[model samples]
Target: MERERVNRKIAAIFAADVAGYSRLMGMDEEGTLARLKAHRRELVDPKIVEYYGRIVKTTGDGMLVEFPSVVDAVRCAVEVQRGMVERNAEVPQGTRIEFRVGITVGDIIIEGGDIFGDRVNVAARLEQLAEPGGICVSGRVQEDTQGRLEIAFEDAGERQLKNIARPVRVYRVRPSAAAATARPALTLPEKPSAAVLPFQNMSGDPEQEYFADGMVEEIITALSRFKSLFVIARNSSFTYKGKAVDIKQVGRELGVRYVLEGSVRKAANRVRITGQLIDATTGAHLWADRFDGALEDIFDLQDRVATSVVGAIAPKLEQAEIERSERKPIGNLDAYDCYLRGMASLYQWSKESNDEALRLLYRSIELDPAFVSAYGAAAWCYVWRKTQGWVANSAQDKIEAIRLARRAVELGKDDAAALSAGGITFAHIAGDLDGGAAFIERALVLNPNLAGAWLNSGWVRVWLGEPEVAIEHLARAMRLSPLDPILFRMQGAMASAHLFAGHYDEASAWAEKALRENPNLQQGLRVAAASHALAGRLEEAQKAVARIRQLDPDFRISNMQDRLPAVLRPQDFARYAEGLRKAGLPG
Candidate 1:
């Protein structure tokens, strides 16, 4: 049998489809078809032509395109994505149409007005890998377009593509222009930016509207003081005060990374304030918290609520940026990126991650020698190691920690994050309780809304043997940042405060809550065991002790005080040791 010679040619194959097309049609068939047609006619088809792409064919929800070069294909895809973003800005999210695009450079079999080949199959598979409103490309395409385009590529790593003979390394394109177009009305500042929209009045009295507006204005003013943040002015933010507006549109108009929208309710002599922080670019809710206080001092309550909201979302914004930095390719790491990545590693709370965090923080410092937050964060890493009983060379670690903390404090006299981090490190690692407390108090004065400062103050008070004050500080931190990633740590500190206050049952309950969040938290486990034992829950205490043994086999009651903060008073340490002994900890 003789095989007919197949006509073939090398080309850049482009594949695209509307994500969730069937669902959109199911929801609104006529409207979906009309919008899809309008998009193709106005945006997609024009972009394809402008980029010198030949549209091979079109299905109801997708189309196949061929280009002379990979550059043309990628450029066209990015334009389409950007155009879709702009067009859908006004459209409701549920009904918005987003496209997934993929491109590859390979040989293709050509027929009369049609095409078929493995390259075509690869392009379709790559499209499936792309996120909605995103583009993915084969490694070959990425190599060809290197330095030829202004787009950034995130290495998605090798993926075992469906039904493909071999694995394909995919790269997700992150177009810088897409971000620019996302906020066409304004350019975002380099620093983390946010806007505080006027809180809605849910108190059923129009008179309460002033209270909500006043709360937002105070928040805006307090947030403006953070040197690290770029806050939208009150005048600009209040433009949407009385109107129903989309968060994404607000983000675009204001050119900010985060949007805070909340509500206020007043009843009798008591008032409640609820706030939520959202990532403007992606519309993801990052943090939310509520504050309740008496209306005896309305202005004072407003000030407290404002400070609380800022305290909560600042870390969340940083966390969101860290996650964003992680998504970028390793080659794209700047000084801030390195710092963010280091913070991410630090939060993992493992020995290995802690080491990596230190290395990355040092790298960040090497890149920017005067980065105060990096120095402060690095100092805290050593403090974390001391708490975990992971310090191998105590003298060397203490010297390095002190050096870093002092540098942070000296350089960042007005930086709250740096001051708080450095101050806590001093208290925990150097036993400079008074010095650390002074620095943290200064941080609070500088940025009263900083949650980290409040948290650090809580621990400082614990070491100072002010258990009641510690509880209050920790409670403030919790209410300010309820969704904080380190919430378990806060809860554990609360348990310790309760334990030292002779509230054994409260200590046990708080420790159990911390354990629920992180079963392997050694501090939480120890607190749980001690509190349960002291509260006469012998069975629960035994269970916690067993888990503590599992986590750290060398745990002993005699050496337990060494694992605790250095500044704990003799009486508090005695109480903790007695509870551990009752819990049957090793002698």
Candidate 2:
């Protein structure tokens, strides 16, 4: 038998590499080579020596170093990145060099000055995962350097490093230059990006821990259905379940603009769920609320929490995105940029804006044919045309609207916006009420947090002759998004629901609310006129009728049958026509 000898020593390994080094070198080999050498000589070499790290080896685009202390390794990485930022200021944007660094602490086999084994590989893998001009470190390195350094570390969750045997917990080092340069700002997705952190289980009962985790996962799933949102996956967010985290750090680590954090307290048959939305860049609390409900309704609470967070953040996100687009230099906007501009136009709800919205959405689809959101929104523009009586050619426009709607549904079967918008278009423009309602129901199943789906469900119920159910669904929509941009739409739905149920005063009240938000909204005026007439407020009813006539002068009670396929439900047409006739509409 031969004696086996193994040499091992715990060491902190640091790996640094230039992001897109191959591309840079390919673009200008001579210039890139000269710059790399100069960087190592002027900035890199001095920092390594000052931190007391030994140079193990150097590749053309990367290097490996051994540090005796994790703190020193992190400090050296930070200083180098800051120096790179300053150096990059003198270069063209296209030729900028950004280095990514990774650090890890583990037992390694040191043959001479060079190191080998899993420890070294892990460091390299971490480097590859790091963002350009950023640092990534293993959980051990973060733990050791926690109190020893002045820098902050953001939890990046568990990462499955390529070829590594075990998963490594990762954190991002917040460099001082993060504030000095826009390079460190989160690269926001074309749409809003958000993360729902694991809920804090304040119940003190370990058994209910599962409940809290489930709540966050449900929220993530619900948010995922929104075509307008880029939601962080559940696996990544749950990594911070038991950790004390900084919201801005989470935002940077996740590369999202908003963060939703909450706590769950369960005791016996009751539970309390509290949530708050934060703007990661400014550390501002965008929204906050709490829900108290029965334990059996825990699932509903989860859905509500998800809905509330999205509803609260969506308008803010949209306004911010719109402002961003408005400020962008002209002629280089991509598909998403056009889409955001279209959204801003559509929300204005004027005839000129409606045309502009349609044009921009069409341009967006032309830019990226696979953009599901643009198609859905484009189809929705036609729905607006029909509702507002702005159609230049009903026959031709209907054909085009149907084509766009069908395409949206096919491309975005899993997206709540597509499903809901396509369904409503089919229901309103194509008069396939049943088929459209089925799609809306599927959208709700895909994402119960979708406030629009709930509101649409209410309208679908009314069209199907289920007025009470319509009211109930609308109430749910309101609770989920008390501050939604579509609140006026929900109010109009509620008004229609009450009107069909013969609750004249209630209908009038809701219609009034809708009109207050959107005085020109056709549905609001129709419902208000009908409800006031049915309640014997003849003067008010006549005033509403006059206002509606200004928007749709050809309006007549008899035309309701052709205009509203929803009137097919039993006596629904008669009910609507009777009220309209009494309100002074032509019969």
Point to the candidate with the largest lDDT: 1
Clash pairs (backbone) in predicted model 1: none
Against the true structure, whose TM-score is highest?
Answer: 1
lDDT of 2 by residue, 14-50 (tens): 9999999999989999999999998898889888998
Q: How much lDDT does each candidate structure score?
A: 0.81, 0.81
Q: Kindly give the stretch of ten consecutive residues in candidate 1 with the minimal lDDT sum.
A: 324-333
After superposition, candidate 2 runs with Cα above 4 Å error: 1-333, 561-570
Task: Give the TM-scores of the predictions, in the order they appear.
Answer: 0.48, 0.47
Total clashing residue pairs per candidate? 0, 0
Judge candidate 2 at residue 337 and give its lDDT.
Answer: 62
**Cα distance off (Å), candidate 2, residue 345:** 0.7
